[model samples]
Target: MFRATETFATHAVANQPEPADPPDPWADDPALRGRLAAQGGDAQTPAALGAAIRDGDAWALGEAARRHPPELRLWDRAGRRLDEVAFHPAWHALMAMGLEAGYAARPWDGRPGGHVAHAAMVYLLTQAEPGVCCPMTMTYAAVPALRADPALAALWVPRLTAAAYDPALAPVAEKRAATMGMAMTEKQGGSDVRANTTRAERDGEDWRLTGHKWFCSAPMSDGFLTLAQAPGGLTCFVVPRWLPDGTRNAIRLQRLKDKCGNRANASAEIEYERAWAQRLGEEGQGVRTILGMVHHTRLDTAMAPAGLMRAALREALWWCEGRRAFGRRLIDQPLMRRVLADLCLDWEGALALGLRVAAAFDRGEQAFARIGVALAKFLANKRCMTVMAEAMEALGGMGYVEDTPMPMLYREAPLNGIWEGSGNVIVLDVLRTLSRVPEAREALEAEWDAGAGDPPYDAALAAFRDRWPGPPDEGDARLWAAQAAALLTASVLARTAPAPVAEGYARARLADCPPVPGALTGLAEGAILARLGGAGPAGESE
Candidate 1:
């Protein structure tokens, strides 16, 4: 006992930061509150959900789910074919909570600001756990795609929009609720979905599909909206997990993808050996039909990066406020203040622009929504990697460790950028929208005009027009997208953000700010940092 006591005494912990407590995501974030209100969304649902997440130990659940990834159970003990994925209990719990809170069902509830509210929920749920969001997002987005077939929509839409969660393996009609998935990409085509090789043949009133899917997201869903080639060219179809006769479909799971991130969710490689399916849209309209789902999913992809940035920054700020270097807190250092203040601009701009796009969706501004979402997704995701890296660096060695959340956030940063569309795809889409749709250009100009009074923004807009009187060369599409997106973000911030925040963004991002982080000349650091509201260690101001 004496020897053990003497050995342990020398290894006492000292000056280590306490674990970051789970704060109310809705209550603690003034930016979220302001943006939600400005977008005409009520806070009651978000507030309640945020509190429930915090109180229900969602932080621990998220950690557990990621630490213990889902497992693919290909066969049962009896050796029968079973293409089922088994998830950790934590994953199931989070899914249940999200579905109950209307993560997938809110926008279809016939309430005002339904889409705006759905966007807010996306932002909030992403902070707690980004992995479990895949199924919920697909389920939410599938409502629109399903509408292409009124009969199918009538059968599936209610189950998809029901405020309940059912993970049973029965027919969708037999379950209390249902979730939807998507299987679009194949080996030959990533974004060039028009080149898909899947074959669909008419079988009586329904159809049968026979092809392989390279990436099938959320493979355990009750049904999937998939694409295949028909006699009339590519077409969209609804492939169920179970046939209407109550037996498993002929869909075979090849293997789950070993991804760099999003471990808690399952992405699969699968083959459809004459799998029964229902046509979702008319033949040869697959691209146009599935785009309805793609459009809405892009909104979540835009908002998720903001949520990730917010989560990482909160952790970094908490660590800095609690730990000290050279007899003063790390947050009190000049360099640290500049770094954090610089990071805050991206978060604020992203939040503002995303919610603004959601408001457009609510108001049925299709032209603006089409172009605005691409800009928001491209810019926000690009900034997310930088913010996540810097925030992790702020914590030094501890941030790299799994004990903290930085590693997960860093892994997840690039996912949204790659999902729905990569950077190049998004840039091309932006150019296409401007070139083909006159209303898209007008909508963009109208948005820029809303915040035209700012001197820096005005100069930038003039330069942008002069630089590209017509669309730039295809090689310069990325440059065009980046500058245009930044300008659009500045415009939105000028109208929605606080005075100092907006002014700083316009001066730094729009004018002469360098490409590097923490390279700043003049910014209201105190006011900028104040937006990340919380008390420091020992009740000190952050």
Candidate 2:
């Protein structure tokens, strides 16, 4: 006692930022609140869910889940086939919270603004944990695709929509609730579903699927909406994990993919050895049927990036506010302020654009929703990488350290862009949509026209039309898509965001501002930064 305590002095921690406790994601996020209200979504559910995530141990749970990735248990110790994936308790806890809060059920709950509310949930849940989003999104998206078969929809929609989480290894009928996954891509054909070779044979009332799925995400779901070649070309089917007799299905888990990210959720390569399946839609209509699911999932993919950007920026801002350098708070430094403020434009534009597309979904504007979501997904996801990188840099060394959430956010940033559709796929789809669906182009133009007063936006719109005239050559497709998406984002911001914020985006993005973050000249720094903490004219805390 005389020697050790006195001789060894431990330095006290100084000028370190305390952990940013989870704010009410619903209440603190004025952009989310404002957009939800503007889009006519019911704020009651989102508010409640946000509070639950904030007040509960969601952050800790998220961290624990990320730390402990899911493990594949293909067989039991007794040498029997199990085909189960084991997740940490934290994963199940987060999944339970999401399902209980209607993450998968809201849109089909017969409520107004169902889609909008569902989109909001996607944004909110993504902030807490991005990995768990894969299964829930598939579950949410499956409802519409399943509706292609009224019988299948009737049997499965209730379980899919039930506000409960049942992780039992049992038949769907035996569980109180169920989650859904999708297995569409084969090794030979990733985005080209028409090139699928998985064969489905008639086995009485049900079909038997026999092929390999290269990527099967959330492998433990109760059922999966899969695509296979049937007697009449490719078709969609519902493949259950367990047979009605409480026996395992013929689906074989080859192995889990060693993915670079989304560690908490399991993605697998599997073989469908005559797995029992029910035909979901008419044979040969697989692409058309599955497009329904793909479309909805794209909406989530679009919104998730917005949530990730928000989460990263919040961390950076907190660090700047509490940490000091050169005898001044980091937030008080002019250069730091410029960087953070410029970053805000991206996060704000992304949130606004994504929600606007969501609102289109809510209003049943299929023409606009189709094109709008693609634009939002493409633009927001691209901006997400930039925002995440800049925000990480703002935190200096701590951002790169695993001790903080930045690395996780950085890892997740590229996933949404790759999922649903990669960048090239999205751009080609936009061209296809605009070419085949004239109404989509008209709707898009109408949307842009609504924000015509901004000079920069107006000039950008004019230049886009003149440059394209009739869908620029495929070589220029990406450039066209990027310009169109940026203009669309600026248009949406003009109508929905505060004047200064909208003007800043138009000047920085639509005009001649450099592509890099913080390379801006005339951004209203005060107005944009004020929105970060939910305290500006347009972003008043609810």
Which candidate achieves the best lDDT against the true structure?
1
Cα error of candidate 1 at position 263, Å: 0.8
Q: What is the Cα-based TM-score of model 1?
A: 0.93
What lDDT does each candidate get? 0.89, 0.88
Q: Positional deviation of 489 in candidate 1, in angstroms? A: 1.1
Which regions of candidate 1 are displaced past 4 Å?
A: 1-8, 512-542
Q: Write the per-residue lDDT of candidate 2 for residues 1-542, one digit (tens) a residue.
A: 13222233677567888655568888889888887777788887778789888877687889999888899888889999988899999999999888899989888888888888888888998998999989999999998899999888888999999988999889998888999999999989899888889999999988999999999999999999999998888899999999999999999999999887788889999999989999988898988998999999999999999999999999999999999999999999999998998888988888888888888887889999999999899888888999999999999988999998899999999999999999888888988998899999899889888889988889988987886777766656666777787888888888888888999999888875225333344566667877687465564443
In angstroms, give how far residue 45 of model 1 lies from its true place: 2.1
Q: Using Cα atoms with residue i matched to residue i, what is each candidate's TM-score against the true structure?
A: 0.93, 0.92
Cand. 2 TM to true fold: 0.92
